[model samples]
Target chain A: AQSVTQPDARVTVSEGASLQLRCKYSYSGTPYLFWYVQYPRQGLQLLLKYYSGDPVVQGVNGFEAEFIKSNSSFHLRKASVHWSDSAVYFCAVMSNTGYQNFYFGKGTSLTVIP
Target chain B: EAGVTQSPRYAVLQEGQAVSFWCDPISGHDTLYWYQQPRDQGPQLLVYFRDEAVIDNSQLPSDRFSAVRPKGTNSTLKIQSAKQGDTATYLCASTPGTLYFGAGTRLSVL
Candidate 1:
């Protein structure tokens, strides 16, 4: 089966601090990866996705993720985080070679302190 | 374009009660998915449809849970007998390129 692991349950960082949320995946074949963010009382929003080509993918709100094939990781990163960036972050793997299959990890709660 | 939309944003019910949630996907999207998100956890896929045809429903609780997308534009998920374990936020999403989500129907079973 395919699964995603988010090592951190919660992460706190000072405002304007750089942030990195770790994610690892277990899949046999090539995997399609995605990062999603859920704000308070809002739905999960797509931050970014990686299917092929560039290993580094840019997303909304100054977020980016690098897919390290050797490690089977797609880690989300930001140069600086704002208080408004506090949200639950999820890393997902698309199981199907097709465009449909999606499996999500237990999210990492990110708190940006002012 | 409008994002995926779900109805009855909040639902409160007693155990054994029945409830249904609805979803309307983006205008031209071909895929729709239903997910169950327990508090403080990531959303788990329950079922999905590829234009009114069920592509995957392996995780859905077949005994009491049912989902359908008859016309291929909108979808509904119903629970015949709600239980405490069913108390979770039900999220609906559609895929154009990436998944667009609805705010979700938060269910509380007492």
Candidate 2:
């Protein structure tokens, strides 16, 4: 069975501070990874996705994620976070099979303090 | 183009009551998914369809939860004898290279 693990339940950082959210996955074959963000009262929006090629994928709002094959991790990062960046972030993974049913992590709540 | 849309954004019902939620996917999307998200938790896939054919539904509570995408565009999910454990936000999503989610229907069972 495929599963995603997001270690942090909540993270607080000051404005302009760099941030990193950890995500790990357990799957048998190659995985299609994705990062999604949800703002207050809004739906989950796709931030970025990694299927192949570049290990580092860039997303909206200056967000980026690096897929590490050895560690089975796809960690989301930002050079600087703003107060508006406060949202719940989720990491999801899908199998390479055509089915491509995605499994999501518990999500990490980010709070940017001004 | 409009994104995935869901109806009845909020609902409150007593335990043992019934409720239903609806979803309309993007114009050209062939894949539609339904997920259940509890407060402060990740969204869990309940069922999905691909052009009127069920792709996966292993996670759905078969006894009381049922979903269908008959025409492959609009979909409905119904829960009979709703329970407190079924109280959660029901989200509808469509896949077009990526998944686009609805704002979700928040269900509260008293």
Candidate 3:
């Protein structure tokens, strides 16, 4: 079964500090990977997606993710975290199971302190 | 120009009650998806449609849950009998190139 795993349930960091959210996926073949963020009282928004070619992809709001096929990981990273960036981050992988299914991680909640 | 739209931002019902959520996808989008997000959990796929045809619905609880995308545009998800375990946010998304989501309909079944 194709699945995404975000090991961290919650992470706290001081504003302006570097942030990294870890993600691991279980899939047999090459799958489409994505990072999504959900703010309070808002829908999930796409951050970035990786299909082929470059392993690192830039997303909106100064977010970026690198897909490492060997580790089966697609980790999200930010050089400087903003207070507004404090939200739940999810890692998703598009399944190749005939239907286009996006398997999502349970999500990691980030709390930024000023 | 508009994003995906979903109505009934919130719904509350007792066990055995019925509720229906509506969604209007982005104009010209052919693929629509419905997801259920419980508190502190990731969104799980419930069903999806390509145009007006059902592509996948294996995750949907057919005995109580039903979905339709008539005319390949607007869509609806109905729960014939709401359950306390069903308390979650129902999310609607459409895909043109990348997938975009609506704010979602939050449901609480007591």
Q: Deviation in angstroms for A60 in model 1?
A: 0.7
TM values, all candidates: 0.97, 0.98, 0.97
- Candidate 3, residue A89: Cα displacement in angstroms equals 0.5
| lDDT value, candidate 2, whole model | 0.94
> What lDDT score belongs to each candidate, Candidate 1 first?
0.94, 0.94, 0.94
- DockQ for model 3 equals 0.79
Evaluate every candidate with DockQ and list the scores.
0.79, 0.84, 0.79
lDDT per residue (tens digit) for residues B1-110 in model 3 = 99999989999999999999999999999999999999999999999999999999999999999999989999999999999999999999998556799999999999
Per-residue lDDT tens digits for candidate 2, residues B56-90, read 99999999999999999999999999999988899
True contacts kept of each: 0.79, 0.82, 0.79
Candidate 3 lDDT tens digits, A1-111: 888999999999999999999999999899899999999877899999998899999999999999999999999999999999999999998875565778899999999
**Error of model 1, residue A25, in angstroms:** 0.8
**Candidate 2 deviant stretches above 4 angstroms:** none
Give me the runs in candidate 1 sitting further than 4 Å from their true place: none
For model 3, the stretches where C-alpha displacement exceeds 4 angstroms are A96-98
In candidate 1, what are the lDDT values of residues B51-88, reduced to their tens digit? 99999999999999999999999999999999999999
A1-114: candidate 2 lDDT, tens digit per residue: 899999999999999999999999999988999999998777799999999999999999999999999999999999999999999999999877887588999999999999
Q: Say which docking band candidate 2 falls in.
A: high
